[model samples]
Every structure is written in structure tokens, then in C-alpha cells.
Target: MSGIFLKQADFFETNGILFETGGFFLKQAEFFLKQAEFFMKQSDFSEESIVKK
Candidate 1:
């Protein structure tokens, strides 16, 4: 009985670690996406300014 309980606890612990890792990666991806968008908008603004001149 104890062995079974230990196995279940181990499984949950592993899953928790995996979820934390996934969450970290997700945050990093969002940060990069926002950065890319900011750069794109800046480039667009410069292009428009040059065209007007």
C-alpha cells in the first residue's frame, strides 16, 4: 500500500516540475513576441516617415 502511494506521489511531483518548466518557457515566448512586435511597429513608423519626406 505504501509503495503504491509513493508511486502516485512521485508521478504528481514529476508532472508539477514539467508544468513549471512549461510555464517558464511560455512566459519567455510571450516576452519575445512582444519584443518582435515592438520592433516591427518601429520599423513601420520609420518607413512611413521616410516616404513622406
Candidate 2:
């Protein structure tokens, strides 16, 4: 009985760790995507200014 409970607890702990790691990676991906979008917009603006000139 105690052994089964211990196993269940261990499984939950591992799953929790995996979830936390996934969340961290997701945040990093979002940050990078935002940075890429910002750079793309900046480039487009520069291109427009050059064209106008």
C-alpha cells in the first residue's frame, strides 16, 4: 500500500518538473518571436524610408 502511494507521488513529481520545464521553454519561444517581429518591422520601416528618399 505504502509502496503504491510512493510510486504515485514520484510520478506526479516528475510530471510537475516536466510541465515547469515546458512552460519555461514556451516563454523563451514567445520572447524570441516578439524580438523577431520587432526586427522585421524595423527593417520594413527602414526600407520605406530609403524608398521615399
Candidate 3:
């Protein structure tokens, strides 16, 4: 459980960095947007599974 939580936290942290950096890229920021969206979805999925169990 701790391992999963840590992994999720890391993903969220990376996503935050990508999102912040994306601000400077303007036209090419879509890549970071996609990355952030993917991580966010994964985080939500993890939370939902934890809740279910």
C-alpha cells in the first residue's frame, strides 16, 4: 500500500512539473497537457480502486 501511494505521489509531482513547464511552451504545450492528463487519470483510477477495497 505504501509503495502504491508513493508511486502515485511521484506521478502527481512529475505531472505538476510538466504542467508548470507547459506554460512556457505555448504552442507545443499540448504534450505536457497530455502527460498531466494521463497522470491525473491514473491517480484517479488508483484512488477509486483503493476506495473500492
Candidate 4:
């Protein structure tokens, strides 16, 4: 607490926020990837159906 150049408490708080933000972005990326995969599967199914008919 004392003699810390940058204030240890503030450093930890900022670090925690950074981690939370990183996690949020990662979840967003994962959600978008899943969405894209779903669309890809749907299009593939549609193509197969069209070819069958």
C-alpha cells in the first residue's frame, strides 16, 4: 500500500476491468462465430434440397 509507485489497489482494479473487457469481447466473438456456422449449415442444407428437387 505504501511506497507503491502506481498504487497497488488501482493497479488490481484496472487489471480486473481489463480482464472483464477481454472476456466480453471473446464471448462476442464466439457468438458471432456460432451464428456464422449456423448460417453456413443452413445454406448447405438448402443447396442439398435444391439439388434433390
lDDT (C-alpha, whole model) for all candidates = 0.59, 0.59, 0.59, 0.57
Better of 2 and 3 by TM-score: 2
Q: What root-mean-square deviation over C-alphas does model 2 reach?
A: 17.1
Q: Whole-model lDDT for model 1 versus the true structure?
A: 0.59
40: Cα error in model 2, Å: 0.2
**Model 2 per-residue lDDT tens digits across residues 1-53:** 23444444455556556787755555555555555566667778888999999
RMSD of each: 17.1, 17.1, 8.4, 16.8
| Tens digit of per-residue lDDT, candidate 3, span 1-53 | 34444455555556657787634444334454555577778878999999999
lDDT digits (tens) for residues 2-37 of candidate 4: 224224334444555678765655555555555556
Worst 10 residues of 3 by lDDT: 22-31
lDDT of 1 by residue, 1-53 (tens): 23443444455556556777755555555555555566667778888999999
The clash numbers for all candidates, in the given order, read 0, 0, 0, 0
Task: Extract clashing residue pairs from model 4.
Answer: none
Better of 3 and 4 by TM-score: 4
Candidate 3 accuracy as lDDT: 0.59
The TM-score measured for candidate 4 stands at: 0.61
User: Would you give me the overall lDDT of model 4?
Assistant: 0.57
